[model samples]
Target: MTFQDYFPIWDKLDPRQQNQITSRLVFRTVQKGAVLHSGSLDCTGLLLVKTGQLRAYILSDEGREITIYRLFDRDLCLFSAACILRSIQFEVTIEAEKETALWIIPVEAYQSVMAESAPVANYTSELMASRFSEVMWLMEQIMWKSLDKRLAAFLLEETAIEGTRQLKLTHETIANHLGSHREVMTRMLRYFQSEGMVKLSRGMVEILDAAKLEGLRDGL
Candidate 1:
């Protein structure tokens, strides 16, 4: 299917606007672990995922990284096109979590369309707001919740996303996702292992009790 079929707002744009976007859109692919965009450093275009997973994260001056959101198939990402937004000042890293195929709507073309099209501008605002809301939710999770609870939630989330109880994740990788140090995460995982909540193996974690994990996440 064409990108027009994939874009949610394509039907809302006028025929000329549609043609402009269609002509400028480019199809692309990246291997797993590739960096698609690097915030203000690269000023990349808007991305619409055709398949595979993308993780959007922020890196601090000290090199700590934390995920803000993840994009899956059919998901549209606005942060990569931050150059068009103007007000965004933070640097975000967009990386491929799995080998990905996607469409890139060049900023020049999209900006030109947005300048003349109210519908596209409004749709862009809605997308920005939705992404910011996810970032805000993540901030709350980090600020208000304890690490143990967050770890529990993360395990449950990974389980659902991968459709398995065994997660092929190391403590260092999990620490990076949670924005904590590896040693701290190791302590918590050890605690979970002691409680028989998870079975820890080399570079892997197997959830043994879903209800217990749910309870931990619920702060019970």
Candidate 2:
């Protein structure tokens, strides 16, 4: 799909306005395993995921990568208010998990477009609010849920997206996403396997009993 096709705001603009805004947008293709943004670097534009997946993570003091979020197609990377008003550099590192397409819009040009279009301004505000709510929900989940419960939830989510019970994940990657240590995840997975709820094969994990997994989640 074209950049405009992915960003519906393009349809709301007049022909002249569309051209002006389009001129400032650039499309770039990122290869798998590429680092799109680093936590220490300053990024002045917004990166919109047009296709594929990006992992938003941070490096710990001990030099381990801890995943904070994942961005899929149609997700906006840097919220407009955070980029413009607060002038805060994005706290997470964005890395391409697969070959991905992205639309990069300069912050200055985006602000100019918002100034000229009330609809765009409102959309930007709404997007920021939604993002904030999602972050809060993630925090709540981490605080309230047990590790096993969180693992079950993550497995269900991955199954829904991948359309399979088996997940192509390593213990380290799962640990990073769950904000736990690799050794901890290894022990938990072993327990789940012993209970016949899941099966581990090489780097893949297969959910063997969905009902038992749901029970674990409900009990948490």
Candidate 3:
């Protein structure tokens, strides 16, 4: 698919604006675990995912990391171009979670279009609002939800995202997603295993009873 397929406002942009983007758009493939953009200063440009997954996360002063959100196919990531969005002060790190094919719209190109096109500006604002909402939802989960519930929810979400009961994930990776310590996640998984909710082995977690897992996630 071309950039037009991934970008929703393509039809609204005039010929000149479209040309500006088309001229500067870059296509790249990144391997799993590649850091495409790091920190607020990187200003890596707008990321439009053609295929595969990317994770947007924040790190603590103590070096602990937590995922704010993940982008899948056809998703647009605005935070990657933090320099263009002057209101964003905090740092966000974007990494490829799977081998990804994507397009990078140069910040200058995007900014130029956004400056002249009302449709592009409105779409950008909507994207920014949506991302902030996700971050706020994550913050709520971390603040009020217990670790066990959060872990159960995360597992169910992973199953849905990967379309399998068997998840190829390490405990540490899961910990990073939920912003918990590995030892803590291990203990929680052990507890879940004891309850017959999951089966864990080296680098894998298989959900034995998703119904019970869902029940646990909902505090039943």
Candidate 4:
């Protein structure tokens, strides 16, 4: 798809603004494990995901990672352009969760357009608010929910996203996403296996009973 196809506010901008953005727009692809943007120091431009997945996360001082949100096809990522979004203080690392195709609008160009266009600025605000809401929900989960419920919810979410009962994930990887230790995740997975909610393999967990998993996730 072209820039116009992915950008919702394309028509709102006039010819000059459109030209400004298109001139600096860059199309690129990255491998699954590639780190697209690291920390709050690098202004990596505004990321428009044309295809595949991206994970946005933050790391603690102790090096534990917690996913804030994820971007998929047709998603716009504002946090990548941290220089333009000056209010964002925390560090966020964005990585390619799958081989991703993207259109990057250089921070300066996008910022210029945003300044000139009310629609673009409004869109940016809405997107930022949405991301912040997701982060708040994650914080609530971390603070109030128990680990078992959180893990069950994560597993169910993965199953829905991947559309498969078998998830090819290691304990370490799952722990990184949920901001926990691998050993704790392993113990939880073992408990789940004993309860017949899931069957664990070397690097995979297959859901044995979705109903039971849902019950656990919902505290039913």
Backbone clashes in model 2, listed as residue pairs: none
Worst ten in a row by lDDT for model 1: 81-90
Please give the distance, in angstroms, between residue 100's alpha carbon in candidate 4 and its true position after superposition. Answer: 0.5
Q: List candidate 1 stretches off by more than 4 Å.
A: none
lDDT of 2: 0.80
TM per candidate comes to 0.97, 0.89, 0.99, 0.98
Model 1 over residues 151-170: C-alpha lDDT tens digits? 99999999999999999999
Error of 3 at 11 (Å): 0.4
User: What tens-digit string does per-residue lDDT give for candidate 2 at 133-176?
Assistant: 77677788889988999898888888887789989989988998
RMSD to true structure for each model, in Å: 1.1, 2.3, 0.7, 0.7
lDDT for each residue of candidate 3 in 107-171, tens digit (9 for 90 to 100)? 99999999989999999989989999999999999999999999999999999999999999999
* TM-score quality measure for candidate 2: 0.89
> How much lDDT does each candidate structure score?
0.91, 0.80, 0.94, 0.94
Model 3 worst lDDT run, 10 consecutive residues:
82-91
Task: Rank candidates, TM-score, best first.
Answer: 3, 4, 1, 2
Whichever of 1 and 4 has more lDDT, that candidate is 4
Model 3 residue runs over 4 Å out of place are none
